[model samples]
Target: MTKIEKKNLAWGYLFIAPAIIGLTLFIVAPMIFSFIISFTDWDMITSFKWIGLTNYQTIFTDDIDFWNSIKVTFIFAIVQVPCVQIFSFLLANLLNSKVKGVSIFRTLFYIPSILPFVAVAILWMFIYNPDFGLLNQFLGFFHIPPQDWLVSNKLVIPSLVIMAMWMGGGAMIISLAGLQGVPNYLYEAVEMDGGGRIHKFWYVTVPMMSPIIFFNAVMNLIGVMQAFNEAYIMTQGGPDKHTYFYLYMIYQAAFKEGHMGYASALAWILFVILVIVTLLVFRFSRNLIYYEAEVK
Candidate 1:
């Protein structure tokens, strides 16, 4: 290579060195260390003890709570992903329309997404409180009975899902942007075919918006699957472990119980599950995601 070429290459590496170093230090190296730690039995307070596959064996055979966390994680993902995505998409669509005061409503809908997650969870906790809470008070005005929003097993998961909906404000903004970009001629073509609003939505809007939908769905799925803060701050694994998400269990082991090794194993297991689930979604989404470049 010429001297100039070598100089350019060196400069390029110099510019990107910080990013490479940061990734190795903060992400890649820690992942490798955690994997190694998973094979041992060491609470942070004690010396390391090699346990081989014992942690995995115990989890598979004896740890009832592990299975419960797995169940709760998947259940939360399944319920939250679609409901939040669809609701946000519809809300965004409404906001995108020529409704009066839409700009105000759009700002209101997205304001929660920027708030601190802990603060949002605390706010929802107040809303869900049975006595002197805003929710029960509003229900009382309508003569509806006060319902246990978070304390009951049946209500806890749903209450968390409702709280998660606040985080979907970002998704609503994305959907709004996608809705605005949709070509007017496409809707006109649907109208010419005597299609109603449902037909236009199903044929024109959804197809045009599929890429945005797919992106939001994957994001929501991953976020819900690895849920922690809502369960931690509000339920703390709940009245009956109904909100005992997988990540929360890992946190409980590592921090609360000081079982760092066991927690690493649990974290790796969740990592594997999330990877497989995400890959499966990508695999099956071949026909679902529509890009405008395809037409070009």
Candidate 2:
């Protein structure tokens, strides 16, 4: 190789070396260690004793919370992912309009997504307060009684769904970008074919934006599966464990119960579930998603 090319290559490696090193030290190393530890019983008080598949067996057969966590997590994801995606897409459509001060509205909407979840949890807690919350006060104006939003088992999941919609501003921005990228020429062509707004949207816009929509949905699914901060900070899986997510279950096992091995097993199980689910989603979406490059 030429000296100049070799020097540039060295510089490129130099620039990425820290990232590689950090990943190895922080993420990859921990993952390997956790996998190994999942097979051993270690409570941080005693030496790890190898127990084969006992931890996995216990989770699948004996522990009730594992099953409950699976149900709760899947239900939460099923509700939250599609709702958040649809809401975000609608918001993106609105924000994509040529109206004045729309950028400000977009910014206002997206601000929630960037805020720390702890802060968001605390803010929502006040809003959900039965006695003097903004939501209750607003409801009072309409003569509606104050409701136990976070405490009631039936209302808690719905309350989290609402919070999830609020945070979907990030997805809105993404959708807006996708909408803007839809070719104007295609829309004009649709108009020439006597297609109305609905026709254009259903045919051209949807097909063109399917990739972005699919990508966001996949990410939303993954994010919902890994959900932790809100349940942890706000409800602590309260009101009869209605918000007890799988990640929270892992936290409880690892930190609260000090069952490191069991927690590790739970984590691995979650990992496998997410992987399989993601693959299934991708498989199902294969025909629905439109890629322009496929034509070429």
Candidate 3:
């Protein structure tokens, strides 16, 4: 190889070295350690004793809280993912239009997403307060009775879903990019074919945007399934354990209860479930996800 080419290759490696080192030290090492620890029984203070599949067995056969966490996580994901995707897509559509102050509107909508989760949780807490909260105050105008939001067993999941929608702008921005990428010529062609707005959207916009929508939906699904901060700060998985997400349970096991090994097992279970769900999403989306490169 030429001296210049070899030097360039070395420089490339040098530039990427920090990221590689960080990944190895932080991500790879911990993952391996966690997997090894999952088979043991250890509190943070005690030496680990190998327990084979006892943790797994306990989760399946004995632990009611583990099962409850699983159920709560699935419910959260099922409601949150679709709501975020659809709401974001709708907002993207609105922002994609040629309107005055559209950029400002986009910025306003995206503000909540940029705020730290802790801050968002705290802000929503005041809004959800039953007695003098903004939501109840707003409802009072119509003589509607005040309703408990995060404090109610029946309302906790829905409250989280509402909070989730407020942060939809991240996905909305991606959808806007996808919408803008759809060739204007396709819409023109639809119009020339005597198509209305509905036809143009259904035939051209929806198909062109399908790949973006699919990508966002998959990411949202993953995010919702692993949700923790909102439950941790807003509800503490309270109101009859309605918001006891699997990750929250894992957090409690590791930090609160100091059952490090059990927490590691729970983490691995979550990882496996996520992998399966991601694979299934890709498998099933084969017919649904459209690509312009595939067009003949």
Q: Pick the candidate with the highest TM-score.
A: 3
TM-score of each: 0.95, 0.95, 0.97
* lDDT over C-alpha atoms for residue 246 of model 2: 95
lDDT of 1 by residue, 1-296 (tens): 99999999999999999999999999999999999889999887778999899988887899999999999889888888888998899999889889789899999999999999888988998999998789999999899999899999888878878877867899999999999999999999989999999999999899999999999999888888888988889988887999898999999999999988899999999998989999999999987888888963
Model 1's TM-score against the true structure:
0.95
Q: What digit string (tens of lDDT, one per residue) describes model 3 on residues 1-296? A: 99999999999999999999999999999999999998999997878899998888888899999999999999989988988899999889989999899999989999998999998888889998998899999999999999999889889888999889998889999999999999999999998999999998899989999999999999999988898997789888888999999999999999999988889999999999999999999998899878999964
RMSD of 1: 1.7
Q: What's the lDDT for candidate 1?
A: 0.90
User: Which window of ten consecutive residues has the lowest lDDT sum in model 2?
Assistant: 287-296
| Clashing residue pairs for model 3 | none
Off by over 4 Å in 3: 1-4
- Candidate 1: the clashing residue pairs are none
Q: Which of the predicted structures, 1 or 2, would earn the higher TM-score when compared with the native?
A: 2
lDDT of 3 at 31: 100
When 2 and 3 are scored with TM-score, the better candidate is 3
Better of 1 and 3 by lDDT: 3
Rank by lDDT (best first): 2, 3, 1
Q: How far is candidate 2 from the true structure (C-alpha RMSD, Å)?
A: 1.5
